[model samples]
Target chain A: MSIFKETRITRLLIISAIILIPIALSGCVSGGSMTATSWPGVTADESNLYIAFNQSVFAINQDNGKVLWRFPVEPEKNQTFFAPPVLTEEGELIVGSYNNNVYKLSASDGHVIWNFTGAKDRIIGGSVITDQIVLSPSTDNHLYALDLASGNLIWSFEANEALWAAPMVDQERVFLSSLDHFIYALDLATGKELWRQDLENAMVDTPVLAGDLLLVGTFGNELISLNANTGDLEWRFKTEGWVWSSPAVYDNNAYFGDMAGNFYIIDVASGQQIERAQMGSPIATTPAIGDNEIFIVTEQGDLYARGLDTAHPLWQIAIEGRMLSDAVLANETLFVASLDADNLVSAMNIESGNLRWQFAPEK
Target chain B: MWDTLILDPMINALLVIYDLLGNNFGLAIIVFTVIIRLITLPLSLQQQKSSMKMQDLQKTKRWKDLEKKYKDNKKKLQEEQLKIYQEIGFNPMSGCLPTLIQFPIIIGLYQAIIRTLAVTPIQLLDLSGHIYQSGFFSIPSSLLPLTSNFLWMNLGQPERFWVTLPIVGLFGIPVLTILVVISTYYQSKLTMATTPGDGEGQGAQMTKMMSLYMPLMLGYFAYTFASGLALYFVASNLLGIAQYSLIKSSKGSNIDLAPVKKSVKK
Candidate 1:
């Protein structure tokens, strides 16, 4: 008769709490757990496509979308590769892993030649491999320059925060953007700091060199042109939303898209908006500039081939998955990497937008 | 609907606090929890009052007589209970109303913390959409890549305190996990409902199981997931204890789940 003795209500409450507590806890952990192993990072050469995905890097036959060889052959729970693999001039593949090691593997057969385990944190961005040196950026806030042939650490320069962008290396100096609101210029040989400019916000993509001005897009909703030599802010152009896509600079124009679904063409010299068009979807990947056409993929999986001179779409196709990485162009075909798709990478004919091949490694 | 009304505002508010607190995420979480607790104070008080009233009514002589009179008839017992409730102008469901209202807040806070830290590319990209980017409510984009390093813990990763002990070399200890387990057990112990009989019914068994299982479940989470959430558990537990203490003090009685003697025998 005691109202407090209601077992049904008590049972229901306990059951609800039991069910909901895990859902709530899992709800918090699931976001990071699911994404900590991020999307596929794809890179290509003349005959092969290299994809660094969840647990292994696969070298695929470019023409047929066949996975030629996958490193390790068996996936490891602890090791993951998401940074776009860097192929050296010497036919060696340089790829960094979530296990905080960079491996130099034979590009032909996928055998480890040398492994560099000096870095304390995950290798998040792609490495820039030259003839003698490999420039790797890590979430540990260090841009490491390693010997190309040996994988030995030559020098390292620590930055203020995580370096999530690949260092743009030239003949003498290296330009690196960081999540710490600074762009750094370092000596190519010694990894010594040359100059750094505080842009007051994080930059997420590789800085594109447009003439003498370094065109860097930011989460701050501005595309800044920094002096390539002294790291001075030359000019900044504001946008409606964040510019996570790296600018494709051609003919003195910087072409990029914002999260607001607005694709913009800016005059690189003066930081002026030449044209802006609503793409109807958020663009997070860099646009692949072709001979007369530009291919841009959006976060919503829409691909548009537009004229270089106009924002009007020449042809648009809706792909089945979210496009996140840069669209890679090779051999008259455009390769797009997507997430939550049946295939990890899809190849399309550049002109007709016909699907050439879609690749997912065999089980 | 969920994102716009609950998650977006919670995330933006947490971010604003992080920005204002000089980029210390741990401090931001504490402050955010305090603010939320203060906002829900009235509702919590009302819930407590309703629970106390129900408990007080069950111990009354009239209620005991009704229980003895209707012992043989289950339907009659329910009818008599309803009549008593009507006469007293009390709603038995009122105690659960505040909890129902506050459920979304708990969910939103957990989500907001995870989204704000953003350890990966996809997480950061997802966070971008929920951010307030314009006008007076805008949080600066510079605040991001919010320094996940709070003290010795990376708020984005599972926390471990490294201790170099003699003869043991280096050991990574789950300090936060232990604290979470202790705090969760204490909170559950404080809030558990009392059984009317000799603690042998299904309800009492469930309450016993919960008192033992909640700490273990949360401890597993703390050990496996990011330390930021574990920190939240600890803070929320301590705050809940304080809130309970304040209510108990003002009302001059403990919210004890101590057994009330059975008037009817099965």
Candidate 2:
């Protein structure tokens, strides 16, 4: 026999093996580290730090990290929160969720005030509450402005891409950076677009406002500065990796970290790198500034307290889980939120980097 | 090992083609399949030659005699076959090798489609890591949301029944599963039809069953998995048919589905 022969059984077995192996292997190769499970969005009033994390919002006591209250008080299917809660002047705590709803709860206790399910997609970004309207940007590519009292839709401004970041309200203009690679500034009252500037790539952070300067970081590895009122380009600073850490403006410099782990303090107007510090991991949120200390948290759960002016590390500490949310400063303590499974929020002493208190959601 | 060896290269290659083909993912998959078929043409030819040689050997008097003499003692029949196979310097498993090699490519291509589509943030971040830095085939920032909207379908979604198509209106008829099923049937039939069913050790029986079973199995996959994978299946089966036809024509073999027609072989 001058040929190769295979049994029909062998062919069937080999084909079955071929089919089964990849299905098994492909399961392992799926995007496993799919964004941190907990992205702690933290905001503070004078007495308590309100955090939206892991489907529930909590108002932790500022003096001692005890859970004042937890929203829903029960778990509901598909209702998870990653965006931090915002406190309105009238004391309404507004937070967004993966379940395509913006929940309004009483800040004093986690009681359901109202729910805004107008946004067609999940509300991942923090909602901006003004005198009359509650503006929430959603993954559905629309920024919904609801009446603050009734939770009714005032109007909606649509973008070409998913709106992953909260809107920046500066005076009469509301600025929003979209994952569609455009930053739109709209008239606060009418929800009419004032100007839209193309940033060339998706931006997932809220645009930072500093007087006339508006800074936005893009996944395209650039930090763009635009005139707050006009939405005109002021300066563009290119980074080594994606500028995911929203810049913290202080004095004359803007401090931020790129996805490549390079932390920089850049002069806002000059577009010059003031100082560079190696953080060794991707920074998740904007640097929080309080009492001369600049708080920067990496996605790996490391927190570094560097001097706001000199960009020198005062102290650095690692939390149990990844710190994906902005840290709130209340008095002498830094309130850090963790996307970790066990701990929800931890408060650390500002100068010493010591653990003050840890707040865990009741299981 | 899968990522560095197979998936990374396939992803970069797909992104390159996607960029070149006006960022149309469907066209990119088709062109990529054609290029892959062209590159692996030598392997297919070698495998086809080996299969034809096996079929011819089975039809010969010596093989029939061996089967008759060792009708009860299967071990003796196998020893005789191995001795002949060694004497001839021909390998039966060689035909299986190319197909075994193709398993990774097929799986890698499936994964690459999903990764390039980048439906989630982490998926996009993963894609960014695998991107080719060179200008030859790079996804520019302008193509941020590489719209999976190809031929009226979101390639990342399942091929729907067209009743809920208004929700997926960007896509066309969603006939990818049907096309895959049809192409799979033809491709399988082309191979099974060409092979002479030597009525030895249930070979003929298995071949007859496969003509129906394989298409349904592949169609089941096409119906459930991402439409992009279904597109790959349809493209791959069609190209396999064309390649088989080319080989058959070159060898002057009869082109017909023997069981279906009942006239091509018997």
Candidate 3:
């Protein structure tokens, strides 16, 4: 009798291979197959909150969490938006997306006005506006400056690595950091380089200008303070984890956290670790600095309100969802986008640490 | 468990190889597959030894006698086969270990190739979560812009459909897949057990069927998945052939899967 001829072992092996191999092959095309949704990031103005939800850019009433108007009235394409849909001085809603197109919509009524398709790759970084130009960095490794009015390409500067960080624009020069470890200061008009300096580590967050000192956090376990004009490194403070959190400076101290959940208060000039705090998990989102307190959220979804100087939390609340985007502080309310909680975006009283209203997309 | 044990390490290793080999993902896949083959060499050798021992047993007259004696009693045939295996000191489970070990690596490498070639925002965002955030092993983001373009194909996409420089693309295109099918055929032919003197035995028939089946099975995978996976399959099969040849060199064995191949007699 042969092994393959009417044998149970052969039957079992064939059945098992039929079952298991397909299951393995299914994992190969894992994206966009399941009903799972990407998380949302929120930005708020006086009366309304703009949300960059998966496949849609939406505006909601700030008082309550009711979704006001959704852009694309109907989603025609399978595009996704993760960057916070920022509002322009013209009060227009402009957001970049996974589809590699930047859309400008009416804030009052969500209708497409102009769409820019200049980027070679998907836009992960939100657009920064300076002097009528919309500066958007894309995974295609190019920083694109488009005329906000005409939606025409102003100029584009190619970087060696992907530009994941949003550009920090000023009057004379636009400051941008790249995954390629170079912090670029370019002429705002011509997209010509003014000066470029290598940071020695991947800069994930935009450089925060605090009194002419550019404070940039890196994927390599360090926070570097550079001279805004010359792009000279002032000092670098090492951390135990990757400093992906974009920092905020309040009263001469830079406040940020690392991948290890170790929060820091670095003296800007000295580059010294003056104070340190700890959370339960990695700090994925930037800290929201208010007048009196700081709101920090960990990747594990624990939100903590702490004093400007102290290492201990004033109050901490577990949102139980991942928060990767920075918290938006609109007046007294601090709106935190909580991912994985049915696409939740919640507002809390910054002073009281009490939940104000929670918005989840209606299924 | 999959992330910690298989996916993360495989991703890191592949990334490191990419970094070392000028960020070429296709080359990285080949190197990584070779490394995996090298690491599993001992297990592969044991399985080969076990399979070869089984083939030797099948080529004996005693096996034919046992089959004839227990032709009517099926349960007794299984029992007798077990007794023969015990007496011959061959472990059947050893024949399974090589295939079993390969399953996770193939799945992990497939997922890794797809994830690393993230062209969309959501895919890149998902990739960010898996990347090394800190430590000495942390890869510089400059090591990105992973070029899947190798000799004739983009490892990120299927080679069967990609258009290119007409003739070179036509000939060199999906060369890896062709090699995968051919090597699979050769590997299966060299590995499967055979029967005694006559080529008419059922064992020889099973071996012949398997030799045809394996190439088609592996070829289907090469055609469907990303070319990077096809490259890995080709590399693994080639390495497997080399190992088989090296092991057989010590004691010369017939390459044919048929029962005791006879000389050409016109």
Q: What lDDT does each candidate get?
A: 0.83, 0.76, 0.75
Please compute DockQ, using alpha carbons, for every candidate against the native two-chain complex: 0.50, 0.24, 0.20
How accurate locally is residue B141 in candidate 3, as Cα lDDT from 0 to 100? 53
Model with the higher DockQ, candidate 1 or 2: 1
The candidate that wins on TM-score is 1
Docking class of 3: incorrect
Q: After TM-score superposition, what is the CA distance of residue A21 in candidate 3 from its true location, in Å?
A: 5.1
Model 3, span A1-363: residue lDDT tens:
334332334335545665676677665553342222344667788899998877678798988878789876766455878766778998997798877898888999888899999887778778888788888899788999999897899899999877877888878889999877899999999999989898777676788888888889876678988899999889988887778767888889888998777988889989988888777788866789877788888878888998765645688887857787789888799888876676478788887889998877765
Ranking by DockQ: 1, 2, 3
User: Which has the better lDDT: candidate 1, or candidate 3?
Assistant: 1
Model 2 segments more than 4 A misplaced: A1-81, A85-93, A105-113, A318-350, A354-363, B44-61, B71-74, B134-139, B156-174, B177-229, B244-266
Ranking 1 against 3 by DockQ, winner? 1
In model 1, where do residues sit more than 4 Å from their true spots?
A1-7, A30-37, A310-312, A361-363, B61-72, B193-198, B252-266
Best by lDDT: 1
Q: Which tens-of-lDDT digit does each residue in A140-223 have in candidate 2?
A: 889999988989999999998788788889668899998788899999999898898988888888899987889999877789
Q: How many steric clashes between backbone atoms does each model show?
A: 0, 9, 0
